[model samples]
Target: MDKLLSIVIPSYNAEKFLDNVLGELVKCHNLNRLDIMVINDGSTDQTAEIGQKYQDSYPGSVRLISKENGGYGSTINTGIAQANGRYFKVVDADDWLDSKNLDRFVGLLKRTETDLILTPFWAFNDKNHHKHIPEIKPDDISWGQKYYLKEQGICPVPSMHTYTLRTKLLQENEIQLDEHAYYVDIEYILYPIPYVKTFEFVNIPLYNYRVNQDNQSISMTNMRKNQQQHSLVVDHVNSYIKEHADGLNPNQQELMVNRLSRMIATQLKIIDLAPIQMATKHELSSFYRKVKDKYYFEPKDINLPMRWLIKSRFNLFPVIHYLAILKMQLVHY
Candidate 1:
């Protein structure tokens, strides 16, 4: 039987969580229609061993690929090349899908040929075990209705967790993400827009995204440590919008800009959260100037402090930094 969906697990040293991740998939009734690719990206621990165990147990449904430690994006590139299903999605090893929702999601894929599929996802905080679902679907859009991206008035921006692309759309376009890069998830989301013409929104919360882990890439400490990589991704997104602006329709252009604005805000926040230093202050000014000149982006959509920093042209950064610290201290007290 042809696989209906390919769930790629880009895992590295995920031994603590791989078992549960694979276990949920194996529980699905439609195993015959699901392809689970466990790409073990050069883990020194037992990641490969755990994946191998699942492969041995599930036979055709699960396959393990082991390669050198390239970053998260390389594992996705490998998965795209090796995918044998009609639809493709990436599920981090630390995250798992809702087993109850798997059959229905696959059923939807089996019937629809939309270039993109959007589904709501659960953000699970590991620290407190609280699950929050973002309002991904706009109230106007009916569930299961196919809409053309070019004609749609309001389109929701999808995170890596909330989207699935047609396998052929990716393979035909040769959609290769940045190799050995930290934040190429944004690249994966942005690079496919020009090729995507039709999409569907399903209200099912299929993905369970694990958050609030100290070692997670999106953590504040890691964001500061990897700020340079984040900036590189921002540059790639900016360049992509410029290179493809003529080809993208008005709606598509708006979508890309909204996404870029959010990335810029994040980069600014990373700078703001760091200790006041000459180098970081200089970075803040330079980044703000570049985006403003190139894209006419403003920081008005973010918090007040960030807006003030932008309004002052980042000159009052030191004052804002101390005031923010004081606010945090007062709140904690």
Candidate 2:
């Protein structure tokens, strides 16, 4: 019953954050039941030193895995494969969880056997002190409630930052994240659906995602530069939907396609960002056409454009995308 939650912290040049994050984690009420794996991802900073210190201090609870730089997704893959606990979660180097919520979650862990655990996370910028728990409301999912993926009524899918999957289930499915990639977190959030049997929503805000960090992939500048990587994830997910929809039941297929639809919509919006070069714009146009054509086969609940206004490659895209963005902003699509 104890030693249930394994938190994988991927640290690459995070000397500034190791002490505070590890310090807070080790002070949790159920420290004995926690397995904290700190992956030193080829860090040239003092991260390894600090990780070793904690490993020595809490010999059984904390362990450090030193590996070459393989980017964030690889670190998660390594950590998941090596986790000693039953439930698994990935906490960023810069983010920390609430200590009280950690205790409460530990309590719930002792009671529930849900395959996927959804919880609220505080999304905020620490510098400005603005924070809010993103509400999962379609008037369906209640906090601290239990439901299956095939459950009736749609609920907002929780972000990877606030989810804990069963370590055994993940390992059984052989979930391999894309190496050296950004936006792989979305892949993690969605790829586990085929295996998940039950889910429980823990309403307490447990995760603190510190936004506005440097080198962040979410910024418009980085998104423009790494837009292809974003597209790579969308392609992988959409491919799964296209190939595997037949094996699932009706409820499972509906949930899977709708969740994937939102993801495609989001990536389409990302592709529509401004200041892109002509070459990349042309590539995006082709990519969009391919994805839209693929989705055309199973267009049950997908809410994309009836017709994209691409006269030629990269030629009417900017104006068309501006209109799409404007429409989305005004109509909440």
Q: What is the C-alpha local distance difference test score of each model? A: 0.86, 0.77
Clashes of each: 0, 0
Candidate 2 clashes between residue pairs 3 or more apart in a chain or in different chains: none
Question: TM-score of every model?
Answer: 0.92, 0.86
lDDT tens per residue, model 1, 1-333? 999999999999999999999999998999989999999999999999999999999988999999999989999999999999999999999999998899888888878899989898998978778888878887777888999888884444768898899999999988888878898999999898988999888888899998767787776678879998998989888888888888999878777887788788778877877788888789888878888888625355456777888888788888877775565434311
lDDT by residue (tens digit), candidate 2, 1-333: 468999999999999988988998998989999999999999999999999999999988999899999989899999989987889999999889888889889888888889988788887765576777777544666777777666643444657877899999889888888889888897788677777878777777788888765467876568768877887877787777666676665555666667676666556556767555686476666666786677622334444352343334446567766775566434310
